[model samples]
Target: MTTLSIYQVSKPHRAILQTSDIASILKLLTDAGVPFEQWPIRPLPQNADAAAVLSAYQSEIDRLKAAHGYTTVDVARVTPEHPERVALRQKFIEEHTHPDDEVRFFVEGSGAFYIHLGDQVVRLLCQAGDLISVPAGTKHWFDMGPAPHFTAIRLFVSPEGWVGHFTGNLLPGLVPKLDSAHA
Candidate 1:
C-alpha cells in the first residue's frame, strides 16, 4: 500500500498527517507541484532481469521517453545484502536537489522520499507500481530503509545520470528512517 505522511521540517518524528489513501496522497503532492500517481504493474517472475523488467513496461517507457525527451533510461536496484547498501543509503539521505527532474517508478519493494517545501516536509512512502516525479530543484532526500530492497526504473533527460547538489541543511536530524522492525 502507498502512504503519505506530513511533518514539520523541525519535527520529522511526529507526523501531522498520515494516510494510505491514494487520492489524498495525489492531492497533497500535486498541490505541492510534485507528481505522484500509480501506473499499471504486472507481476514478474522470481529473479527477473532488468531487461525483462523494462520490457514489462515498454509502452509506458516509450511514451514517457518521447514526451520528456529523455535521452537514457536505466534500472537501479539495491538489495539487503548489497555490499555498498549502507554507503548508497547515506549518500541520498541528505537534503539535495537535481538540475533535472528526478523520476522513478518503483518496480519492487519500497522507499521513502522526504520533500521539503517551505515550512513543512512531505514524507512519501512509495511502494511498487508507484510513480513519483520530483520536479527539478525541489529540496528532498530519499531513504531506502536500513535493509534496502528495491528495484526502480529511472528516467533521465540527460544521459549523465543522477547528479545531486547537496544542501547544507541536515533538517536537524529530525527525520525518521524506516525502523529495523520494518526492515
Candidate 2:
C-alpha cells in the first residue's frame, strides 16, 4: 500500500495530513500541483526477472511516455545489503532537485520521498503500486533507510540521465522517518 503524509518542516509528529486512500492522495497532490498516482500492480511470482516486470507494465509505460513526453525508461533497484548501499545513501541523502521532473513507479519494496513545498514537507511513502512525479526544481530528498530495498521504474525526459543538484540543506533528518506507522 502507498501512503501520503504531509507535515510541517519540523517533524513527522507534526503531520498536517496523512492518508492511504488513493483518491484522496491524488486529489491532494493534484491540488498542490504535484503528480501522484497508483497504478494496478501486477503480482509477479517470486524471482520473476526484470524483463517480466517491464513487459507487464509496457502499456502503462507507453501511456506515461506519451502523456509526459518522457524519452526513456529504466529500472533501478537498491538494497541495504548491497555492498555499496552506504555510499549510495551518502550520495543522495541530502536535499536536491533535478533539472527535469523526477518520476518513479515502484515495483517492489518501499522508500520515502520528502518534498519541500513552501514551509511544509510532504513525506511520501511509496510502495509497489505508487507513482510519484516531483516537478523540476522542487526541493526533495529520498530515503530507503538503514535497510534500504526497493525496485522502481524511472522515466526520464533527458537522455543525459538523472542528475541531482544538491541544495546543501540537510533538513530531512529534522523530519519524520518512514516506519511501520507510516506504512
Candidate 3:
C-alpha cells in the first residue's frame, strides 16, 4: 500500500496529514503541485516480473506512451549488492536532466525524492506502490538509503537514451536524510 505523510519543513511532530487513500493522496499532492499516483504492483518481482511493475502503473505508462511513445518496459531491482549503486547515487545527486519525463513506480522499499523547483523544495517519501512522475528538465535528487535498495520500473521515451544533465551542484551528500519512521 502507498502511504503519504506530509510534514511542515519546520514542524516535525505534528503531521500536516497522513493517509493510505490513493485518490486523496493524489489530490493533495497534485494540488501541492506534486505529481504522484498509485499503480497496480506485481509481487516478488525480479527477472521478468519487472515488466509487471510497469504495467501496474497504467496512468504513468499511458502518459509516457502518449507523450514520448516509449515501448519495451524494463523492470529493475536494486539492493545493497548492486555494483552500480554507488555510481548511480552519485550521478543522481548532481541534479541532472532527462530527455523524457522521469517516471518510476516503487514496487518495494522506500526512497526520498527531493525536487528543486526554483525556490520551492518538495520532498517525497516514496514507498511501495508509489508512482512518481518528474517532468523533464526538473532538477532533483533521490536517496535510497545507506543500504540502498528498491524495485522500480523505468520508462524512456527517447531512442537516444536517458541522458543526465549535471548541474555540477554538490546536492546529494549535503542533503538531510529523513528518519525511517516517517520515510
Candidate 4:
C-alpha cells in the first residue's frame, strides 16, 4: 500500500492528513497543487529491457502531466550498494526545491524521503508503490535513508537533473527515521 501524510509544518507530532489509499492521497495532493500518482510495472529482465521500463515510466509521466503540471519525466536509478551512494545521499540533505514540483515514484525497493517545510520534517518512507510530490519551491531535503537503494521515476518540467535552490544548511540533527512501525 501507498501513503501520504501532510504535516502542518508548524507541527510534527500530528499530521493534518494521512491516507493509504492512492485515490485519497492523490486527491489531497492534487487539490493542493502538490501533484501525485502511481505506476504499475512488470519486473525487468536481466538483459537490456530499458525500453519496457522507460515505457512504463513515460505512461506514469503522462499521468503526472494532467495531475501535477510537469512538462517532462526523467528517470534515475541507484542500487543498494553503489559506491557513490553515501556522497549523493548527503548531497541532498540540504533543503531545496525545483522550478516545478518535485515528484518521485519508487519503481523498486524503498527509501525514506524527507521534506522540511517551516517546522515540520515530513518523513516519507517510499516503497515500490509510492509516489511523492513536493510542491514547487517547497523547502525540502531527501534522505534516501541510511542505505542508498531504490529506482525512482522522477518527473521534471525541465531537461536538467535536480538542481536545488537551498534554504541554508541549518538542518536539525535529530529526527525520526523510517521504520516499519511508522510506515
Candidate 5:
C-alpha cells in the first residue's frame, strides 16, 4: 500500500501525520503543490524490457509530455542484482535538487521520496501505479532501499537527463532510510 508521512524538520524522529489512505495522501500532497496520482496498471511480460514498459505506458506518457512540455521520456529500472545498486542508491539518498521538475511513474516495486518543505518533511512511499511530480528546485531525496527493485517511467524537460544539485544538508542522514523505516 502507498503511504504518506509528514514530520517536522526539527523533529525528524517523529512523524506528525502518517496514513495509507489515498484520499488523504492526495489532499496533503496537492496542498503542498506536489502532483500525485495513480495510473491504471498495465500488464507486462515476466521480464519486460524498457521498450516494452514504455510501450505499455505510452498514452499516459504522451499526456504528461503534452501537459508538462517534457522533451524526453525514458524508463529506469533497478534490481537487487544490479552491479552498481549500492552506488546508485547512495547517490540518490543524498539530498538534492534539480533544475527541472522530476517526474516518475512507478510501473513496479516501490521507493520512498522525502520532500523537504518549509519546516516539514514529507515521506511518501510510492508503489506501483503511483505517479509523483516533484517541482524543480525542491529539496528532496529518494531511497530505493538496500535491496532495490523497481521500474519507473521518467519524464524530463531537458534531454540531458537527470542533473541533480546536491544540497549539503545532513537532514537526510538524521531521518531513517527506506530499509530502516520498513523494518
Candidate 6:
C-alpha cells in the first residue's frame, strides 16, 4: 500500500499527517506542487532489461516526454543482491536537489521519498504503479531502505540524467526511514 506522512522538519518523531488513502495522498501532494499519480502496471519478465522495460511502457513514456519536455528516459533496478546497495543507499539518503524535475514511476517494489517544503517534510511511500514528479530545486531525499529492491522508470529533462546538488542538511538522517515511516 502507498502511504503519505507529513512531519515538522525540526520534530521528526511525530507526523502531523499520516494516511494510506490514495485520494488524500494525491490531494496533499498536488497542493504542495508535487505531481503524484498512478499508472496501470504492465507485466514483464522477471529479469527484464532496460530496453524491455521501456518497451512495455513506451506509450506512457512518450506521453510524459511530450508533456514535460523530458529528453531522457531510463530504467533503474536495484535489489538486495546488488553489490553496491549500501553505497547507493547512502548516496540517495542525503538531502539533495536536482536541476530539473525528478520524475519516477515505480514498476516494482517500493521506496520512500522525503520532500522538504517550508517547515514540513512530506514522506511519500511509493509502491508499484505510483508515479511522482518532484519539481526542480526541491530539497528531498530518497530512502530505499537497508536492503533496497525496486525497479523504477526515471525521466529527466536533461540528457545527463540524475545530477544531485547536495543540501548538506542532516535532517534526512534525523527522520524515520522507509520501514518506520511506512509503519
lDDT of each: 0.87, 0.83, 0.66, 0.65, 0.93, 0.93
Better of 3 and 4 by lDDT: 3
Off by over 4 Å in 4: 1-33, 46-50, 66-71, 179-183
lDDT of 1 by residue, 1-183 (tens): 788888886666778898999998999999999987688887899779999999998888898888878778899989999999999998998899999889999999999988999989888889999999899999999998789999999999978999999998968257667662321
Q: Residue 57 of candidate 2: its Cα lDDT?
A: 91
Distance from true location, Cα of 11 in model 6, Å: 1.2
Ten contiguous residues minimizing lDDT sum, candidate 3: 174-183
- Alpha-carbon runs more than 4 Å astray in model 3: 1-25, 32-34, 45-64, 178-183
Give lDDT: candidate 1, residue 97.
96
Candidate 1: which pairs clash? none
TM-score comparison, 3 vs 4, better candidate: 4
- TM-score of every prediction relative to native: 0.94, 0.90, 0.72, 0.74, 0.97, 0.97
For model 5, the local distance difference test gives: 0.93
| Per-residue C-alpha lDDT of model 6 across residues 117-152, encoded as one tens digit per residue | 999999999999999999999999999998898999
Tell me the tens digit of each residue's lDDT in model 3 across 1-183: 455555444453444666767777788668766668665555554554645565566666787678657764566677888888878666565666676667777778777776765644456778877778777888777776667778877776765556778777554444455444433
lDDT of 3 at 66: 82
Please give the RMSD to the true structure for each candidate, in Å: 1.9, 2.1, 4.2, 3.6, 1.1, 1.2
- Per-residue lDDT of 62-157 in model 4, one digit per residue for the tens? 766886566666567777677888788777766676776777888777776666655655555578867787877877777675676677777777
Off by over 4 Å in 6: 181-183
